[model samples]
Target: MIELQGVHKAFGPKRVLNGIDLTVPTGESMVIIGGSGTGKSVLIKCILGLIRHDAGQILLDGEDVTKAERDAFLARFGMLFQGGALFDSLTVWQNVAFRLLRGSLKRPKDEAREIAIEKLRRVGLKPDVADLFPAELSGGMQKRVGLARAIAAEPEIIFFDEPTTGLDPIMSGVINDLIREIVVEMGATAMTITHDMTSVRAIADKVAMLHDGVIQWTGPVSQLDESGDPYLDQFIHGRAEGPIEAVR
Candidate 1:
């Protein structure tokens, strides 16, 4: 449903993305695994049109959406940012219903609140929690609220950045399971970027590794261990001494 062809991006003197080619089919979950400063986040920003690529085509549903009709195109996606990115001033319900309250996709307040509560429930949050502020919730709860917001509109496509970062293993598992469940329930095309191996195993249908601003490997999740690519091996196994450079 989404495709990037020959994408390239640069920031002044530094070129972060070089010839990126990727595709996420409808209803499939693709996870990007890479080390810090490998341009993984840049790749995702390009997809969202937050960071325009210097050259290349971004096609959504067989149409070029790089500069034209971007608004209409972007509304199709829901994103859970790396840090949850919630509005501190807004209550939990308002945060989840932000898109629904003001946008071309806007819904009435009563309806929006109902949808927000339902979405919260979908992510295992009780309705009572919707009245609480973000600061009142734990990190995991905040992440769950972010998840609820992302799917509140039942978007056709979703982007999850570092979905399992900064959480304990058990909490990470809960969030991962919620992500997997919602993605499947919505049948939405999903893309996640994360370094956690547990997240990869839980959320990815396909895996792509980014190294040196290029895709080092792309394959099914089940084939990751047997890909015979040293880069994939080094990453998934967390091997310190390999082709992927790491300094002690």
Candidate 2:
């Protein structure tokens, strides 16, 4: 449901993305794997129109996103940022229902809270936790709350940035499974960028490896091990010696 053709972005003298061509089909989870400073986050920001591309086109459902109405276009998607990004001032339910209580998607406070509570349940959070503030929760709980908020609006598309970044192995696994389940249950197109191989294995239907601002490999997750690409080999195995330079 999303496509990028010859996408290029540069910041001053540095070229961050160079002709990135990628696609995420409807109802599929596409995970992007790359080392730090390889432009993975920049690629997603380009697609989301947060960082406008210098050239090329980004199409969402066959229409150019650049020309679409900003608010209406953004409403079709949800995002879970790298750090869980919950509001310190808002309670759990209020944070989850942030979008629902504002803008074109606004609903009555009671209705929004009810939906928020239901989504929290979906992400394995109890209703009792809804009244607590973000600071009152553990890192994993905060991540779950972030996931609940992402799906609270029932978006057609979702973007997850480094979903398993700071969690322990067990909590990472939990979050990964929750992401996979929610994406499938909602049947929403998903694009995730993460360096965590375990998260990729658990959450990706398709995988794409980015290197030097370009896609080095793109295929089904099942093919990742046998893809025979040097870059993919180095990344998935965490090998220090490969075609990909460790020095960046």
Which one wins on lDDT?
A: 2
lDDT of 1 at 85: 93
lDDT of 1 by residue, 87-137 (tens): 999999999999899989899999999999988998999999999999999
Q: How many backbone clashes does candidate 1 have?
A: 0
Give the runs in model 2 whose Cα sits over 4 Å from its true position. none
Q: What shift in Å separates residue 144 of candidate 1 from its native position after superposition?
A: 0.3
Which pairs of residues have clashing backbones in candidate 1?
none
Clash number by candidate, in order: 0, 0
TM-score of each model, paired residue for residue = 0.97, 0.98
Model 2 worst lDDT run, 10 consecutive residues? 239-248
Segments in model 1 whose C-alpha atoms lie over 4 Å from true places: none
